[model samples]
Target: MKSKKVKESVTIMTQIVLPNDTNPLGNLFGGQLLAWMDLASSVASKRHSEGIVVTASVNNVSFTTPIALGSVVTLEAKITRAFNTSMEVFVDVWVEDRSGKNRTKVNTAIYIFAAVDENGKKRQVPELIPETDEEKVRFEGAMRRREMSLILAGKLKPKQATQLRALFE
Candidate 1:
């Protein structure tokens, strides 16, 4: 399969926080933001895979700032790296100013997705080519993050995590 550029799989979504989406504290609910991130990242994974994709794991989520009700929120997701059958996506959430002229990053998340076929079997995905310096940095860090995830899940032995071991050596 042909390699795909990270920009090719970028997905952006914008939403206005509503009363129904907020918690009693009058801030956007964490679950609501997670759902939006999931949807956006899934679209990016599908674009990179060129097929159906399912969320495998949410590796990390950082809620840095509270989003007020009626605030304009934007989510930007892109494939950071593609493995044999899975991809790592990074989603950055931003809250726009009242004038919509500037944006403040409020949250960030890392998600993993697996490409699947009609029968729900895992399918191969094209290699990802990172272009920008930020993309390259994310791509390089993906292996270490993947290893840590697997180790925490007991899917990989700590001794077998070469990427993680490199940190100590």
Candidate 2:
């Protein structure tokens, strides 16, 4: 499989937060934002693998700020790394003011996707190539995140998580 650059799989989605997508407080609902993020990241994963993919796990999701209704929401997702049949996607959520003047990052998340065949069996994905400095950082960090995930899932022991243990050493 040929290595794919992060830029090649980057996905950007923009949407306007409507009243129906907001909470009683007029802020964008957490679940709504999560759904949008999932969709955006799925596009990135599919672009990278060029095959069917399913969300394996959401490693992290942080809603740092409340996005008000009527705000423009933009999601950017890119493949950070690929491991055999799975790939890590990093998503950044930005909120634009009603006036469309300012944009602020309100959330970020990491999602893992597993490439699948028509039969729903896991399929191998091509490796990812980090072209920019930021991509390189995310690519390296994905390894540590993957190690910790496996450890927490009981698929790996702490002693076997060398990538995660390196953070403390």
Compute the lDDT for candidate 1.
0.93
Q: After superposing candidate 1, which stretches have Cα over 4 Å from the reference?
A: 166-169
lDDT of 2 by residue, 111-140 (tens): 999999999999999999998999999988
Per-residue CA lDDT of model 1 for 131-168, tens digit only, reads: 99999999999998999888888888877888787654
Off by over 4 Å in 2: 166-169
Write down the TM-score of every candidate: 0.95, 0.95
Alpha-carbon lDDT, every model: 0.93, 0.92
Error of 1 at 139 (Å): 0.5
* Candidate 1 accuracy as TM-score: 0.95
| Candidate 1 residue pairs in backbone clash | none
